[model samples]
Target: MEKLNVNPNRMELAELKSKLAVAKQGHELLKGKQDELVHRFVDMVRESKDLRARLTEQFSDLYQQFALVGAELSPDFLEEAFLSSGNSANITGSEASIMGVRVPQFDFLLPKDEISYPYSFSYTNSELDASLRKCHRMMQDIIHLAELEKSCELLANEIEKIRRRVNALEFMTIPQLQESIRYIQMRLDENERGNLVRLIKVKNKIKK
Candidate 1:
């Protein structure tokens, strides 16, 4: 705790008291912000966990389905089918504010033209086609899940920063200010008592 080097006078004491009040108020405001950040971070963490689990399960199934289809089809033919079958999405990116942090938001623009599967029927079976379509549809979910994970990463960083600030004010700044105030008051009281004793001695000498 660093003590301010200043004369222990009434004027300096008043100034220090005012500074202390301002520090306390700022500390309260920071604490409130920290609480809100923590709340948002907790929600994001849960969402991220759920999304990751879903993606893992769905992707595993997709891989297995593709593998089964591969056993029946030639490698060259399967590669050609996959290369031709991928669908394109219309994605628009935007920014959204959560608390004070800005996170990314995406909108998928629906195409006016009818959506069709990319693979030819001659080369692909029904289950193969179905898996391909399912994977295409999940593109949006995959993008959204990516967005959520990135948001969580950003929120985690901000949370750490706010935590440090709150800790500094709570454990260090407020206490130091209070201690300085107490020390000044103690010195002022001692000075007043010394003055009083000297005045009394001078009066006694004058009377004699």
Candidate 2:
């Protein structure tokens, strides 16, 4: 026969019940947060798509300009122009937690007035210079959007996972535990009653 290790002290049952309540509360709170995150993530994805389209158009325009400047300017001239523009960009990442999920935060730094390349190059094409500036700005925007989209994805995934775990504990594990506890309590009561009847019978026999 398989031995049943039923907890008679009731301590384990109380502790598990407490944990079940906490798990249920956490599940509800996380579910709400998950819904919010889904909304936010959808918005970010839509924005990302629009931004990517716009960036593609801008890049096509830049390439056409590059081709127009062709034989007259070496590829080095484009590179040198970029360097001479005296603008630099730095991207940094940090972490933040939302509903027990760690998400990434990005910081962008752009420095201005680092180079006097326009006057030095003796290139009178202001339009090309303007296009370069537009490209630089677009690049920074793309980086920021990419980071936001990725973070949104990660947070959404984590929220879904936590929600599932909560559901399993609430709907399955806790109920099963409580059912087992009830069965054990009934069996113990039945055993006590049987012992009491046996003791009474023995007392009557001894009196006879």
> Among these predicted structures, which one has the highest TM-score?
1
Error of 2 at 161 (Å): 3.5
Query: Candidate 1 lDDT, tens digit per residue, 1-77?
Result: 77767778889889888988998898888788878888888888898788889888989999999888888888898
Q: In model 2, what is the error at residue 94, expressed in angstroms?
A: 3.7
Query: Which residues of candidate 1, in runs, are more than 4 Å off?
Result: 112-115, 206-208
Q: Candidate 1: worst 10 consecutive residues by lDDT?
A: 109-118
Put down candidate 2 lDDT per residue, 116-164, tens digits, no spaces: 2444447636656666666666767778777777877896687678678
Tell me which residue pairs clash in candidate 1. none
lDDT (C-alpha, whole model) for all candidates: 0.81, 0.69
Q: Give per-model TM-scores.
A: 0.89, 0.66
Residue 3 C-alpha lDDT in model 1: 70
